[model samples]
Target chain A: MEQSYLIDLKQVVKRFPMGKGSFTALKGLDLQFEAGEFAGLIGPSGSGKTTLLNIIGTLDLPSEGGGTVLGHPIEHLKASEAALLRKERIGFIFQSYNLLQVHTVFENVEFPLLLLGMPSEERRKKVMEALDWVGLADRHRSRPSQLSGGECQRVAIARAMVKQPSLVLADEPTANLDAANSHHVLKTMQQLNEAFQTTFLFATHDEKVISYLKRKIYLMDGQLVKDERV
Target chain B: MKLAWLLAWRNLMGAGLRTFLNVLVLSFAFVMILWMEGVMVGWDQQSKEDMRAWSIGAGQYWHPAYDAYDVLSLTDAHAVIPKETVRSGLVPVLATQASLFPQGRMMPVRLNGIPSQQSLLKLPTAALDTTMDAIPALMGTSMASKVHLNRGDRVLVQWRDRNGTFDAMEIELVDVFQTTVPAVDAGQVWIDLSVLQELMMLPNEATWLTMGEATVDSERMAPFVWKPFSELTRDIDAMIETKSSGQAVFYVVLLLLAMLAIFDTQVLSIFRRQKEIGTYVALGYTRREVVWLFTVEGSMHAVLAALLAAVYGIPLLWWQSVVGFTIPMDTEGFGMAIAPTLYPVYSLGLVVTTFVLVLITTGLVSYWPSRRIAKMNPTDALRGKIQ
Candidate 1:
């Protein structure tokens, strides 16, 4: 059976104002992704890849047009409601592995659950399971600074997947890693994706990242130039 | 809420140097504020105690004339004095000036004459008994020394009669009184009331009466026409008011400086963590949540500082209160024998107020920055720039 589309972006637009003029970061783009689909948004620098990811992540609203995510109308939701939706259903992984530097690996994974007001026992169970999935269960007590690049990315992945959200947005998650570390992180993420059946969306210019995705989205400037299946 | 608190705690600990400097500055400010408040309250309480000792005698009292110079005539006393007033508990005393001669050396001295021994008993104990009869006069230590009189020596008390006739009487000095306040005891004599009446030639009248206990109920006392010692200490009251105004002005300036320091540090902390705050917002925390989180952090800092200040402050204040801070022995004219000491009295209200002030200022200063976090696109935060 074909799963329904979880994210649908229709003619999304974003603009930036420079001195005496304007810069269009996203010039009327349309995109859609089905549930459980592993997709990659491949674009060069300044191609509005992060902007589009932000819009889908509900971190930024479209200046023009409307869309929906996970059956909720994005345009109609208030800032608080959008935040609620993000907390409950959306998970984010950043390029720099934005785990709170002061928190240990386990604590970073437990953060979203804490925000969700989950009880300690349940949060521990979920966090441990997520850490086990990332193969970082032994390094649970290590802080971000103590971890290597691959370990940090794995911790970030654990943080993203611990909440068991329906959608996981990864923005250049392997940009900071070496070739070997990058391959390891990608393998760990693919394994988690298969095991949890959580949809993965990657915004990256890395050919390595694009090759791993089942669907590829190509962007030029602020517009989508191509969409293809592997 | 717990997550926010945890984040705040760890952030405070993560940057050791910044946290130390911030807490040091805050603790110093806290100490200054606590000390100032303590001094003000201590001074007020001391003044009240002094007043009670001198006039009201710890509680309240009623007197004959509102103005000290408006003598309590026999007729006026009957009209103003309450009908069921506790007479036995009241002490009638005469205060006047008299000329004295010791071996041909003459000087004027203030004389306080009480009706009975019980009245003198209520006065605080100096080295000598405050009570004296015709044969046993209590002379101030300074007066006794100047007059070259031993315990058995006699002095001539001379004064002008109501008719302008000059008269002299000799009395034996039985005891010499030494007080903590040397100035008060130096030029005064306490004698029995009958001897005073004979000397002043007002055999049937008393100058003012002191109540050993409160005769006027606080509620009823305000509306009732009553006299107080304020009339006698009008000049002193003016001087005290001037001193109070100066202290208040000084404290206001100090508090303003302290507030500015608190404001600056909190603002700097928020600005430095702007990106992190934006990330928190992007992680589904609202603007209000951000504000509350920082406010709670500031409050926690204040509470910790307050606890430490209390530990150090209480002992210092108590020691100062008990032993007193000493001034140079050679300092003259001020006549303050027991030197001024600041005793900070800690109250829950003060702690609460300090905490609230810190929290509110932190919330206000961090408000705009935290709200900016909510307004930023998460991608910008992730990129470490809002623009």
Candidate 2:
């Protein structure tokens, strides 16, 4: 039963302190994600899309009820355990293309594998293969600052998929890109998800991203409003 | 640990000028500390060497009544030389109190009597044996200049005989000697031992006997204390130790400036690289790992600085040792054993100790600020928040 779900959340509530009292970010939300699903948490700002993405990524703990991610309890996990879970099983792509500015494209893509303690020869082979997938194999030596918006996103996707993780969490992955680059990054992620059958979870309000997701979950004011198969 | 070292090295290299400036500052500290300490060590060795040559040859045998500091003790300090010491090694020297009138001004003086034919010590006392009008004597350059006496000049000397009667005579200054050691040259006059004994009415008696090594049998020499070279120079050693302790403050200040540069760099790196730190965490690095990465980066500054110091410091320190450092003050009457120019002597231990001190200091300075990373919230850090 646990193998069927990559992420399983039940009665999850998240709150953050605002001045004196606490503000509820997620209230009694239940969500289940099956393996190899291309899903998006679609909501506007203040609807907790980023919050949910962070929770799923084990970057935050639920304040009220808890859930499991990759068969490990998410709420109040030790820092080392959470790091290991994220390191071995989860991948993240941020809106600003959080590629290390100083590292070349190859080094950035190879970072996660390095943390996973992969040896040099195999790590090089896997990194090159991931670069080949993102179509940035020729730009491996180029730094992030030298790349365009679309190229930087391609580098980020290459970095995320280099480890071939079970789930990749992208937070507004196309926010900084124009329409052409947005669709290009989205279509690349779509192809990577289908080819590797790796689960992809996106937090975005962008319509272009919505059109690509196989399933969309809509949240409004700390509550899930709709779930639909696109 | 190897991965941390590798990434830390890469990060430092990528930092470019900021890293270079920190390393340069730390390197300066290493050079300054080592140089200063080398000078002190050189000074200590030179003082001991000069003492051994000019004044206390290996050791000395003092008469029970003799105390070099108290002039009254010198009057009664003389005793007949021991028979056992006369054959192989010991050379007797008669020390007595006297007064001189040079340029019509009264000056207190020590009249040291040395055998004209002895080679057991470094004093140029052979110059005292001369066929001159008055008793041939030698005065240090300091005493010569103060008394306005030249090599051939005669000065009036007053002394006491065996009957406690006062006597006056003119003594020829056969030679004026130059030496770095103040003990031999300050307010002192040297005369032939036979002549001094004849004048003082104390024949065949000496204040102390100098020998080549510590071979004097203390049991046979019952009333006399045989002072070895180690005991003879204990005061000088203590003085140098006290001076070194006072100088440790300067070393601390120098190291503090270097450490401040490193500490500032580490704190700034933590602030500026928070995003990179978060990225590291998100990539599955424990917060502890990130701390280690930053710590290694900071401590590596000392390593780089040590290399940099070797590039420039080696030649400079070697040249300084060869050329020696000249003091600005006139050393003519500076009453202690010191040379006009001091040559630095650096032992292997001094160099290694200094390096370890800087390395440990840098590691601590780096770790103090980097510890904050372990407490940083991963989610906030990922957003590049200031927390």
Best candidate according to TM-score: 2
Model 2, span B237-313: residue lDDT tens: 88778778888898899889989998999999888888788788888899999998889999999999999999999
Q: Name the weakest run of 10 consecutive residues (lDDT summed) in model 2 chain B.
A: B214-223
Q: Is the docking of candidate 2 incorrect, acceptable, medium or high quality?
A: medium
Best by DockQ: 2
Clashing pairs in 1: none
* Angstrom error at residue B199, model 2: 3.1
Cα lDDT of candidate 1 equals: 0.67
**Cα lDDT listed for each candidate:** 0.67, 0.88
Backbone Cα, N, C clashes tallied per candidate? 0, 0
- Residue pairs with colliding backbones in model 2 are none
Clashes (candidate 1): 0
TM-score of chain A of each: 0.96, 0.97
